[model samples]
Structure formats: C-alpha cells, structure tokens
Target chain A: MMDSLAAVLYLILFPGFVFLLVFGLFCEWVDRKVYARLQNRVGPPLFQPFADLIKLLGKEDIIPKNVDSILFQYTPLIAFAAVMTPIIFIPIWSATALFPLQGDLIIALYLLSIPALALFVIGWSSVSLYPLLGGFRAATMLFGYEVPFILACLSCGIIAGSWRISDITAYLEMYPASMLIVIPGFVIALLALEAKLERTPFDIPQAETEIVGGVLTEYSGKKLAVMRLMDDIRMVVGSSLIAAVFLGGFIVSYGSISWAGTDLTNVINFLLYIAKSLMIVFLLAVIRTLFARIRIDQMLDFSWKYLAMGGIFQLFIAVMYIGILHG
Target chain B: MDLLKWARMKSPWICHFNTGGCNACDIEVVAVLTPRFDVERFGVLLKGSPRHADVLVVTGPVTQQSEARLKRVYEQMAEPKFVLAVGVCTCSGGVFHGCYNARGGVDTVIPVDVYIGGCPPRPSEIIDGVVHVLNKIAGGGLAEKSSVNEGQAVQ
Candidate 1:
C-alpha cells in the first residue's frame, strides 16, 4: 500500500506532471530563444512560456454555442493526461523508469498518438468549418507520419533486441560503441518525430496562414493553455525518447570523472539527461527556423516517399549490423 | 500586482484584423513582427485566433460589410481584451472617411483602447501603441475604460 501510494505521488509530482510541465516549458523557452536568435531577433524572456500559460488560464473561458460541450471541454485535458503518462515510463535519470514494463515502448508509441487523435476530435467536435477542415488535415498528416515513425522506432528495438525501453538503454550501455551504427536509424526517427510534433515544414494541420490556427482555431482560455502545454510536453517526450534510444539514456559517465558517491553520480546523470534532451530540442528548433511550412500535399508526399523509404533502409542496415556484423 | 495580472500584462498576444482599408497599415503591422522591430521581445505574439489573443490590433477603416465581422471578432475574444486601432483609417476612416461603404474607424464597431495615427503608422509607432495597451493593462484601467463603451455600437 505504502509503495503504491508513493508511486502515485511520484507520478503526480516528481517525474510526472509537475516535473514534465516545468521541463517542457523550459524546453519551449530554449526553442523560442534559439528560433529568435537564428532569425536575428531578440526572443521573449525565459519566463515567457510560463507567463503565456498564466495569462491564458486567467482569460475567460468561452464555449461556442454550436459545439459539443462535453468533448470540447474535456479533450484538451485528456490529451494532456495522455502525453503525461509516457513521461513516467521514460527513464530520465536512471536505467529504469518509475513504471518500467516489458514491451512498454509499444505502449509509449501508442500513447504519443493519443494527443493527435484528441486534436482531431477537438477539431471535429467544434462544429466549425475551419476546424473540420483542420481535423481532416490532421488525420491525413497522422497517417503520413506514423508509419515512418513506427518503422524507425522498430529499427531501434531490433538493434537492441528488446521491445522494452529500459532494456534498450541497458543494451546500449553494455556496448557503448554500437551507438555509431545506430545513428542512421536515430536520424530517420528524429525527422519523423519532428513531423509528429508538427513543426515547420510539416505544420499543415495547424497552418495559420491557410486555416487560421487550424484545429486550435476555436480553443481559448484554459483549454488553449492546456493544449499549448500538451504541445510542449510532446516536445519533451520526443526529445527524451531520442536521448534514451540514441544517446545512451542517463549513462553520462564513461569513467572520465569518477565520483566517490552513487548519489553524486545519480545527480550528474540526471543533469546529463537534461542536457541531452535540450540538445535535441536545439536541433529541432534550428530545423524549425531554417525551413518554411510545406504544402499539405507536399508534406504527405515527402513523408510517404522519402521518410518511409529512408526509415526502411535504415531499419535494414540496423538489422544487418545487429544480426550479422555485431554478432 | 497579482501574478496572474502580471502575466497578462507580460504576454499579450495580438490578433490582427483588417476591417477594410488599403494594405499599408497591414504591412506596417506585419513589419513590427519582423526581425527589425520584433514585438516578441515584449511577449507580444501575432496570434491567428482571436480566441487566444489578449489584444485585437484592427487595421484598415471599418467597412459596412466588416462592421459586423469586427464586432463578432471582438465578441469572440476572451475577456480582458483590448483593441488597438492602427493607422488614421482605423482610427477615423482616413481617406475613406466619408466614402459610401466606409463605417468610420474600429471604434464604430468595438471599443478601442489605443489609436495609432498615420496614413500607415511606422512599425515603431505600432510597437509603441502595443506598449501603451500594456500600460493600460498594468494600470488596472482596462476594465473600467472598456465598460464605459459597453454595448454602445455606432449607428
């Protein structure tokens, strides 16, 4: 009972809602700052994301009369909860997570899709023209990206010989040098993740110029704030997943600086995990800054033709490396 | 001030609405968002949805057809909304002041807090106008001032 209670507290407080929220907002700050710098503009202050959230929360909540009241009100919260669940399964500062289970990687992948699904529902339930169109676009984009993303993740699982994320990290730690061979698959997966996050070059679903905020056109106040936070949390999840799968999750010390205490090493590992996640976010921001939004058809075509092919090719190479070369 | 109020003042997302004037003021407003002026330094983002915006930046003179649209957009915005009427046209219809279809300024449709006067105000002036709206928000005068013109639409 005590252990269960502790787990619940941990889920709600430390590595779950509060921690992910703060970390996600920080990552958002880094993203915006880097984007601004790249464009030769001064960005908002470090507290900008936090301020935006607070302001949104303080605004009056408006529910359009024509909308389905129940779904419209609850979808953002559900989406947020869905995104927060995976953080508990991801090993941030240790080899094992708060709730590590065999074959959790598949579950994590499934959980990541819920937010996009929720977005589609939000768009459809709003009973508005722009949002309905946005919803259809979002669903189409989801299909376009999910295949390549799954294939890329499948490659990582094949290389590590385990469907569990902790096992994958353990395998990587056992043979640290194998990361070089995994880089190609990781790059393919990273690009897919960028599309999944709906950044520039693949932001057709939320194309502001074309659809007036797209699926988020009708959302306001607390709901909008929740949705924005969900996006940031998705960023955290994507970058952390990349860090764990490619960058050797939380194994910061390779005998360079030997700390006398395990506690100190743990602290260092935690900080290193944060740094690795931030680095991935910085890379994503650079991609966002350099590229313009692509047309919906163009995005779909690129995802289906180029990314899918690249993912398969990388997966084949990983299979060869792990099956024959490494063996 | 309270943290919520401080946050509201710090991050004011503006939604630009072109009621119906020449494209000059709209261009100037967009310029303010570019690297040169960068209104984002003050956490002022050009939001695509009025639902997510704190300040409604209305450019162009209010046309007969857009008067209802302007009112609807203002109504669509969540509470504590401020309107910044950019350019003389948006302030009082400028060159199109007495034209057949002109409906005067944005003030004719929705209450405006700040008026930026120019044929097309420079990006600097637009930024200044936004800062002034921030000042109004910080002073706690937004509510009382907006209430004065509540439900009073121009004929």
Candidate 2:
C-alpha cells in the first residue's frame, strides 16, 4: 500500500505539482502586470506569487470554533491536490504526456471538478449559515456554467473527430485549418473556465458582501495558502489546455541564441503556447477587474440564451469546416 | 520598511452600515469586490463580524428605526473602531434631515472618525477614507467619542 501510494504520489505531485507551481507563478506575474497596466497603476513584482505563498504559510491559521473541524481541515488540501492531477496529462511540447492514460482528459476534467465540489462541501459543513448559502450559490453557478462549457468542448471534439486528446492533436496536421477551426468554440469555452475556475464577474457565490469571504471565511494558515495555490494552478492548467487545443503547441525554435535553420518548430511552438495561454489568462483576470458580478439570474440567462447562442454559432462554424473538408 | 509599514498601518478592516441613505453608496461600497478595485489586494478585507472589524463605515443619515439597529451593531464591535459618516445624510441628514425620523448623519448619534463628504463618495475615495481610518485605529486613539445622545441614540 505504501509503495502504491508512493507511485500515485509520484505521478500526481512530483512532476505535476511542481510544474503547476512554476507555471502558476509565471501566469500570476503576467496577470498582475497586465491588470496594473490596464488600470494605469504599477503592479507587484513578478515574484509576488512566491512572496504570497511564503507570507500565507507564515501566517497563523485561525480556526473558527463554530466550524466543522473535519471538513474545514481537509477541504483545502483536497482542492490543492485535486486540481494538479489534470496538469500532468496536458502536453506542453508534443503529443507525449508523462502519464498518458486512456480517458485521462475526461478523468482530469472530472477530477478537476472535485476540488470545487469539496469547496462547496466545506462551506456546507461549516457552522455558519452564510457559508452554506454561498455553497448553494456555488453549486448553482456550477450548473449554469457547465452547460455552455460542455457544449463548447463537445463541438470541438466533434469537429476534430476524436475524443482522445492525442488523437485529436494527431488529426490537426491532416487538416489545413487545424486548431483555428476550434478557435470560436475555444472562446466560449474559456469564458466557462473563467466562471468554473472562480475568477471575477462570475465570483458571485464567493462574493465578500453576501457570504463574508464566501467559502474561505473559516480557512486560515497553510490550509488557505494551499487553496490559494490551487486556485492559481487551475488558472494555469485551464488556460494551458485551451492553448494546447486551439493555439498549436511548439510553433517556433532557435539555436542556442545563435542563428540557425529551424527544423524543430516545437520550441517556438512551445513559446506560442505559453504566449497564447498567458494572454488568455491575463485577459480573463482583466475582465474580472473591470466588471461587477451580474445577478445569478442574469448569468443564467447569458449561459442559456446569449453564451449558448455564441457556442452554437461556433459549433455551426466548426461543422461547416468539417463539411467543407469532406465535401 | 518603516514607510511601507506606515502605509500598511493605515489599512484597516472596514465594516459598512447603511442607515437610511439611498442605497447608491451601499451599492458602490459593494462594487469594490468587482475586479475594478480589489480591496483584498490591499489587505483591507470585509470581515463578517463586528468583533473582527476595526473600521465602522456608516452610509446614509441615521433613520429612526435603523438608528437603533446601527447602535446595537456598533456597540457589539470591539473598541478602537472608527466610524465613517458617509453621504450628505450621514453628514447632516442631507435632504432628509428635516424628516422627524431623520437623525442627521452617523455623527448625530456616534462620533464619526472621518466624514467622507459625498452624496456617494467614489469607491476609490471610500477606500481612501477607510485607509486613513486604519491609521487612526492603529494609533489606538478611538476613545469615548460618543455622541451626546448615546443613551437616546436611536435605540
């Protein structure tokens, strides 16, 4: 059991968790910088994420006597680890992943959802009724966002003619339009991610006004730190997947800083991937900074009526592409 | 480090109360959570309980019924708390002061730490006032600045 646990730990945390931390830090750096620029204010240093993790780790963890101690203690850890599982399988350079399993993407997506569900549970199990209300709101938000999200992803999968991500990537080269065919669908998908990942505008459930830090009111110390870290990584992994699926990995390469012909576009493609993901992640953050939360009813209306309309248009465009290909 | 520390010192946990003003100020206050002015980045959090809060932000003039609830919430808060009398109503009951129920601004009942002096001060300005109030709290100077009507102060 120990060895099996160790093996699972190696696959989940060793490379996966470490990579997520580094990527999260980088994405946060870009996000803060862009947000500052957007508002014409100087932002924090690029190493701010590193500083925050250190600071939060050092702060005393405050526990509310009123809280359900068991759920309160474990939820953040579950969330921290759960979101990292998806990153291990996302290809940064090629179709190769360290732990490429059958239906890994599907598992990753579902497991990726667990952390948030745990958050909802944490809120429910807590003593305060306010957090319970926030938890209900979070569950409501999950329902509203997932409809558009599932539609967007399914449309892309249908267009690519594969559910397996690696197979989908393999088919990319066979078509001239390639990842661009999924671009419109990817946009709506990114917005759903913005909500699911609990970024701004869609952050009503956790709105400080209604729920008083929403789900995190009772959390403190290393637990809160871990949860914060988890949030950062979700942004990274979600954006990275969007980039990998729609932005084409490894678009360019260079020769040790000296001029040379590029046979391997993988390095450049990696650069493109990073750049694209960073841009999307920062844009999402900007949207959060710029807008206020809409009423949940309004958001629901958007999901079913407006955002879904956009997703259908994207699906229409994608099917049109496939039709053109075979026709 | 000291200057930065001083800057940090000026930041306080603000608790807002809406007495009887038009909810415009209350709405603007809540709007801070929107991405535009993330008060969390400044370490100025919106704590849930009065016990945890250091700054008491009161918007609207004190109305007869709400004035009592306001005082109760205010009394429940631990000491070293600064009150922000926001809007014209909170300042002097504004346009509503003549009404028999209007008790002028929060100052009419509680000694306001800072008067934010706008019908609805911009969110950034409210942030500024709250930050200034934090300095006052950190200095440990919130004494018996109670109003003349502490006994008859609404409640």
Best lDDT among the predictions, by candidate number? 1
TM per model? 0.95, 0.68
Model 2 misplacement above 4 A = A1-15, A173-176, A249-267, A316-320, B1-155
- B1-155 in candidate 2: lDDT tens per residue? 34433433433556778887789888888876555787656645566655445567888878888967998777755444678776667777778856887775677676777777777778888877876676664564556355544443342
For all candidates, state DockQ relative to the true structure. 0.88, 0.10
The DockQ assigned to candidate 1 is 0.88
lDDT of 1 by residue, B22-101 (tens): 89999998998889988788998988888889899999988888878888999999998898999998887788877888
| Regions of model 1 farther than 4 Å from truth | A249-262, A325-327, B143-155
Candidate 1 lDDT over A1-327, as tens digits, reads 999999989988888888998999999999999999999998989999999999998989999999999999999989888888887777776777778888888998899988889989999999998888888888888988898888878777888889888778877887887788777767777778888898997888888888898998999999999999999999999888878888774484344344564346557678888998999999999989889998888888988899899888978888888779656
Could you give candidate 2's per-residue lDDT for residues A126-226 as a string of tens digits? 77776787788788887777777766766666677766555455455445366766767777888888888877788887777666777766565477668
> Residue B20 lDDT in model 2?
73
Query: What is the C-alpha local distance difference test score of candidate 1?
Result: 0.86
CA lDDT, candidate 2, residue B146: 51
Instruction: Give the least accurate 10-residue stretch of model 1 chain A, judged by summed lDDT.
Output: A253-262
